[model samples]
Target: MADIEPYENALDAIPGAHPYPRTSRYHDAEIGIHRQADGTEVRYAKRRLLPPIEDRTGDDTQSHTVRTGERPDLLGRRYFGDPGQWWQIADANPVLDPRELTDEPGREIDVPLAGHFPRSPQGDRRG
Candidate 1:
């Protein structure tokens, strides 16, 4: 057995530490442990499923032209009022790399209105 950290997230069922960055895209992701043959416990955050492009974008979405020297953190603050929520901007765009959205000036990017995803980590859109 290896050293293990403890946790008390009300949403989590397993006994392990939750991921850092409470506002991160992986905030609600479950903690997984891989037991090696040597009994070493490798803990990792499970994969986070991105919401559908359509769900994240709609007629209400805002289109902003990227300016030179602009960054996602700043954009997040401008839009969501929290720099850590930058992932919301990334989710609204189609670019695999969020940095690319700001790399070139004059590129229009989609800014979803008030984050389009649900409160759950599973992206439960059944409602």
Candidate 2:
């Protein structure tokens, strides 16, 4: 899969969630598996929900003007020192799709304060 590292990182950061199939379209989704009447297994997946916009707003929040060729992971690395934390920026914005959120140039996005997110484990922060 193309650009799967961000998804893997996000999934790793979520606590106590079921492990999703890496090859599934729902690889980035939160999922539950269930057994059907005879012996069939079904997987139900939902896009992970974000916290309310109000919850992400704060005095320390900062804004970034989208520049050409910028992406969430790139922005995360630039601002937070960890590219894997892209979801933090995605969750703070209003768009349901993070790709759309970062696709345009000149768009403005709110960046949550660094303290609002969990710090990366000492060894995990890497380019």
Q: Best by lDDT, which number?
A: 1
Give a tens-digit lDDT track for model 2, residues 13-121. 6774435433322345545678999889887764554455654445747888998999988987887777776777876778778786679999988888765632222
Model 1 / residue 31 / CA error / Å: 2.0
lDDT of 2 at 88: 74
Lowest summed lDDT over 10 consecutive residues: which window, candidate 2?
117-126
Error of 1 at 55 (Å): 2.9
For each candidate, C-alpha RMSD in Å? Answer: 8.1, 9.2
Clashes of each: 0, 0
lDDT of 1: 0.71
Segments in model 1 whose C-alpha atoms lie over 4 Å from true places: 1-17, 57-60, 118-121, 124-127
Per-residue C-alpha lDDT of model 1 across residues 28-117, encoded as one tens digit per residue: 666689999999999897777776675443564788999999999889899888887788888777888989879999999888777344
C-alpha TM-score for every candidate: 0.71, 0.55
Instruction: Tell me which residue pairs clash in candidate 1.
Output: none
